[model samples]
Target: MNSQFWDEKFSLNPNLYGEGPNEFLKEQLSIFAKGKILFPGEGEGRNALYAASLGWDVTALDQSYIAQKHTLLKAEDSGLKLHYLVCDVSHFIPEPESFDLIALIYFHLPLSIRDNVHQTFEKSIRKGGTILIEGFGKKQLKYSSGGPKNEEMLYDIHEIKSSFPNIQWEYEFDGIIHLNEGKGHSGDGHVVRLRGKIK
Candidate 1:
């Protein structure tokens, strides 16, 4: 989706993806000491806000201005500060090795540029920095839950592993899991979960 596509979506729904961080992201981040973190496609700022509360210097990027506004408002209400940028993922270029961690939660992209985008993400994190991701698996098409219906946009364990060849995986999973991440995502779903560190 482009900026206008997401802007309209966020503008229409007050909490498109809920106000809480993804369950997987929350669980994984709890074990790490606070550090600079990046959240791409962070719609509505749920994860970014949560990270800021945990003392991480959080930077969130999204294509939607409406989403950015909602995130900033939530951050202010919670007395937490976050760095948010309104830009398309294709145009966003983070400083090399600038982040201790990067989170990609349900951030699906077109197959055409998926590899390039992941490459950018790989370069954005410092050596040995961690990456945590949870996204719809290709089998999600069989379910009526969230995520893109297009199979090409969905992920698989092998595809994810190949996309980040420089990462040494700690855990990689692909299976059905129940989700209750607010109204935006609720129900049993097929997903791929990956936790890895840069080599």
Candidate 2:
């Protein structure tokens, strides 16, 4: 979808996607420690804003300026400070050994960009840093819940393990969850949630 699609959707009398972070993200927050966190493809900044409220320095990156505007508005409404940028993930390059936590929740990517993104994640994470990722699993195709229809965009445990060989997996699994976040994603969704530590 293009920016116009999202802009028009968000311009509705009511909000298109309501407020709040992804439910799986809320569940994973218990593991977060104080540190700089990177949220790639952070549309609307719900997750980034929530992390900032918990004292984490957050940088939310997305391609949509409109989405970034909404994210900033949401952050202001919550009295939380957040950094946002309208940049394509493909061109994003974070400093090496910089982030203590890097999150990739529902940030699906085309195969051409996935390798570079994974490499960036691996290189940017500080030693002992953690990466928390939650996204549609391959099995998600069976459900109608919001996610890319492209199976290539959906991840599986084996694929993740193979992609980030240096990262030690703390946990990786697939299951159904009640997603009550907002309109963009709401309903029982099949997802893969992974937690890994930089080794």
Candidate 3:
């Protein structure tokens, strides 16, 4: 995947996922005190912008330059600011304990680099901080609702748990759920959700 693919898609529609943040992410953030948070693979910055508006120090990363542009424009429109970076998740290396939270909403990656991405992100969160993830489950391929068509890129509970071995699970779910985030993610789909603290 290259920036051009995303640039054209985003250029066609700014609200690919929607203008609002993920509903699951919004609900999960209520329990945490605002602090430094990172959103990896953050496309269009909906979640990051929402966190910024809520007074959280937000940093967003994505591979698409056009995506960053759209997100920053939205941030400006909302009177909010966030540190947005255009970088590939596979190559990103965050400083140790740099984030109070790492939110991965639909942050799917290729299997070749998924493990490394998880390992890199694991060291970025401070002790007692949270890693919240919500993405389509393996069964989502049955639906046309937004998600990778490739089964390998979809979420698997066991593989995900193994990725962040130090996580002390606080909440987890894997089953069918109705989604209405935008035209991209609408209707019933199988999804996995996890909220946990790193030991």
Number of the predicted model whose lDDT against the real structure is largest:
1
Relative to the true structure, how large is the alpha-carbon lDDT of every model? 0.91, 0.81, 0.91
Q: How accurate locally is residue 3 in candidate 1, as Cα lDDT from 0 to 100?
A: 89
**Superposed Cα deviation of residue 194, candidate 2 (Å):** 0.2
2 versus 3: better TM-score goes to: 3
Candidate 2, residues 100-135, lDDT tens digits: the string is 988988888888778778988889999999888899
Better of 1 and 2 by lDDT: 1
Order of quality (lDDT): 1, 3, 2
Global lDDT for candidate 3? 0.91
Q: Measured by TM-score, how close is model 1 to the native structure?
A: 0.98
Residues 17-62, candidate 3: write the lDDT tens digits: 9889898999988888999999998989989999998999999998
Q: Which 10-residue span in candidate 3 carries the lowest summed lDDT?
A: 1-10
Runs with alpha carbons beyond 4 Å of true place in candidate 3: none
Clashing pairs in 2: none
Per-candidate TM-score against the hidden true structure: 0.98, 0.91, 0.97
In candidate 2, stretches whose alpha carbon ends up further than 4 angstroms from where it belongs are: 1-9, 12-17
